[model samples]
Target chain A: MLLQQQLDGKITEQKDTGTPLLQVRNLKKYFPITSPFGRLKGHVKAVESVNFDLYEKGTLGLVGESGCGKSTTGRSILRLIEPTEGSVNYRGKDLLQLNQREFKGFRKEMQMVFQDPHSSLNPKKRIGELIEEPMEIHKIGTKADRMERAMDLLKRTGIREDQYFRFPHEFSGGQRQRIGIARALAVDPAIIVLDEPVSALDVSIQSQVLNLLEEIQDEFKLAYLFISHDLSVVRHIADEIGVMYLGHMVEKAPTDDLFANPLHPYTKALLSAIPIPDRKQRRERIIIKGDVPSPIDPPSGCVFHTRCPFAMEQCKSIKPEMLQQSDGHQVACHLYN
Target chain B: MEGYPLLEVKELRTRFSSEKGTITAVDGVTFKVDYGETLGVVGESGCGKSVTAESIMRLLNEKSTRYDGEINFKGVNLLSLPEKKMLDIRGNEISMIFQDAMTSLNPVFTIGDQIAESIIVHQNLGKKEAMEKAVEMLRLTGIPSPEKRVHEYPHEISGGMRQRVMIAMALSCQPSLLIADEPTTALDVTIQAQILEVINDLKEELNMGVIMITHDLGVVAEVCTRVAVMYLGQVIEESDVDALFASPRHPYTRGLLKSIPTITGDRSQKLHTIQGVVPALDNVPKGCRFAPRCPYATDKCMTEFPLLETLENGQKIRCWHHQEIMEREAASDVITAAT
Candidate 1:
């Protein structure tokens, strides 16, 4: 009854759109390096001052190269890895400030779908049991009710009802990912943090999963924090995109706006790097020089200054703040300034 | 060797004997690569694209793996070559760069030592001279300060640099044929572009024939002169790169093209996905291998296997309904244009 009431309240509240479902501000996650004897070495600043808002039923894509801390930012929002600083406001409540007992109540509202379907699901457990495990922990329904709901979720996710008893090992990578999605939906989450969800699957399988995600997002009215390294995949799903580089959000804009008129140099280079399949439409690629630097001791000021083709003297010293270029388009680059 | 192609694979069939049964990984695959040309073999996972490359290089374990058909390199049959003769031709006449550079390189040896080892063995050069050539190869790959980077261990350099070193080592002997199996799959997009550029530059300089085996069509479009689409261990389609992308005759090829969400793709419409997963190697289909997943599969497709027929435009298609599909596509294109 309480869950129904919460759902009803959310439906009414979503219409107003006054505040975001989740508002992240100045989020930072730093991992400390230590010697064998536990002497403090240096901190690997994985995420620094990341900020974004995920409205109800919206999709936010976090994209970057490896070690760009896109995954770190996603984890930090859920407090899966405790954030070193900043606030994660969910419906006006700060998640970072909530204690373990207090946060347990909110955990059901947000769930995560991990990458690598092969390793993520336990080999021994049946697919049905995996979906029901979340509901059983949350104590939402009785045993019979949970089983029915699990079956419904499995059916909705394109899995056969008869195959519910089969183990994860029996399913393909795409099917395993559907099971992962079904399990996430079991808790009835408002926001799902998907980390490189389709990168492991083939292109044909990837499209199926992508389509399934879109369908589920509409049915459940769920928001997504889609974290991936593939720009093309992100472009297809995300409403808004946040481009990160060396633990900082270099640019954030609506998907179409970002791709059409990318303001940041890093964003431009990243956009151009994607090899388009069309033989006729060969793009003028920006081909940025060198690899991403180590995030432990990132370059001063702009982390991307070392790689930025338009890097100026000021870019090496003074950090560029996220300045709004136009409506809903923000970029952190000295060139924009 | 006057009129012979640099590398020509004819009716190649590679099978592996497992505890369950024998599975044909590369079934009757055929293609050719001339000097200064790239032939791209593209397919999804478990489609035997990698197996085809490994078959060409004869890298699979001989105890469990069996090969049939001809792998002719400059008019000489590589499949018939003795093990001792194969060793002489393997790295010296033809080299391969694998997907994972870190795993492919020796962790203990410096990049210089590794590259020099191939040069020393192949060119019969002195250790010092081979090391100098290694640095030159590294420099040719566009790695900055090759002299300093040459001495660094595999772990000491970045992923992009390590890949450059791998390319350096592969090209140190200046092989006429190079087989790159998903060389840039593990790399970041920016780094991938750099590596692809290096490969293209080197290919031109050496006038080498390259066999690029990857699942990514984007890479195929960027580098390949010709492309072969594979499905369930069979080459479904083969054409010039331009013709392949412009008009993919096979249903699997069409499905594969529509499936990928390009950077500039229309976001409003849902992606076209190929129904059903790839069948397991053990459960190989009887008739058309792709008939189970094909949208255009007919009763005839399910009952009889289609031969890989060559079309008038030099395109090969392994589908019974290729003509009908082309006509339907043309009609649809006209409708779209009228709208």
Candidate 2:
């Protein structure tokens, strides 16, 4: 099949289906801790009831501190790790219900670009083979056709054709990342989960990579789950932003609105904490007290209540449900409730 | 000592002999940190910021790493100092906190033992007295329940807590000069803010000259009194924090500032980025180091190395075409006005 025909197939397929590209509802992934003696310890509620919708060509940015289940959410959505329970409605198909054999079919449409370019790619394989292997496994094209598309992907990702024969170690960090992006784009995925794609690169290279991602997004019309701890970086690309705390989606809103008027205490704290380059901005920073409670034994009621300044008696007992405000801005906090 | 700076590096060069070859990582970099002020040394990775700090501390093995030029501490040239004297200066007068809290700290030792070890070694206090002092130092760093935290190992504590412990250890001996090399990089934003505040408070209280080495311009603007922007192991630009942010002379400085994604900027706006990556240390470019990546590179910039020249506002710039750049900007503005 021709590249143009494959692209048109996607267009027709999207047109045929009225449902959102990906609809994740009440996604819960829990990991049970076991002692050395095989005794049941506690359950780490890594992702507790994560709900969000991703449209075609839209980018949803997940922002949180380290170990806040932002990365876990992306992995669970891709089913890279087994999500304990949830309905991952990928274009009307419930992805979570599918077994390993069945999930393999959906794997082509949902791809991932990892953080470290150096370690992500298999060292033994040539760069060309790395990109070609995915399509070869999916049986999308013939050997010659797959090779051609891989080279095309290399060119589209701004990598030289000659470098495709080179090993991963030969290229610079930025160039290696381009190869990673090229590999992710090889399958013509509908949505890509980019986990800290630009964090490992330098500031100059970060912008370059970010610009490339934006251009690619425009050209391919693909949705992106841009997961990063950098709020500023996320603000630049993300349309909708979700602030994760412990294991819950504390706040969800449009990027501009969230940055402008953050309702949840955690969201407000997160926004205020970002160090603006301009000293003259003089924004008052809200430093939350203590570390995030261990996921194996998370705090009761509101997980953020221990660190939250406005925590009251109600917050310490009853968990605050996500209250929908005007214009799809939802915040889960007792203060808002 | 009347007019002397607290710490000053004059034409400092650091070279490491590896299997490949002897590569000059930090080439003739010079800067000064005065008493009770923080001098922010800002640069990207491989720009020799950390190497410069390490050179000042004499942390590199003298066998493999060769140092040229002078490192003056309290009006005394430390290059001539013997290993015995240098050992005394390491934690007593000069202290460094590195980037990674996870690896920099010993996982086996309790937090109290580590902090107290530094105290006992430098201050000559008994283990019992040093242990008490360790708790005091932890408390000063704003660690909640220092008594409990002191008993925990490096792994038991969080990243932010480990960093706090590192700072407490660095400050235990009342070091006049603190070289914090990316202290907040491994931490979250809120924790970074906290760490910066703690450093600021301690700097003021002790009146210690701080050499804050970081890649973050935001941290520089917040904490530093003066800033030195380095590229490929040389100080390309040096100005007061206000002046550096207000009017960055070097193209690299401007590019870096613009490259930083800010929440204040228009969403999804394409950031201004320098064309190329930092060259490998072994493959350092001749002439102006930034010529390859610089947009303003001319024949002169490519051929001849630009000397660090102090400008009218006491801002230092190392660019052959900075004057021409200003003139061009003026001309372009006039042209736009005429239109």
Which candidate has the highest TM-score of all? 1
How would you encode candidate 2's per-residue C-alpha lDDT over B140-249 as one tens digit per residue? 99999999988999998889989999999999999999999999988988889889999999999999999999988888988999999988889999999998888788
lDDT per prediction? Answer: 0.92, 0.89
Q: List the candidates' TM-scores in order.
A: 0.97, 0.96
In order of the candidates, what TM-score does chain B achieve? 0.98, 0.96
Give the per-residue Cα lDDT of candidate 2 at A46: 94
For residue A156, model 2's alpha carbon misses the true position, in angstroms, by 1.2
Candidate 1 lDDT over residue span B242-271, tens digit each:
999998889999999999999988776789
lDDT for A301 in candidate 2 is: 90
Query: Candidate 1, residues A239-286: lDDT per residue as tens digits?
Result: 889999999999998888899999999888888888889999987989
Model 2 chain A is weakest, by summed lDDT over 10 consecutive residues, at A8-17
Q: How close is candidate 1 to the true structure, as a TM-score?
A: 0.97
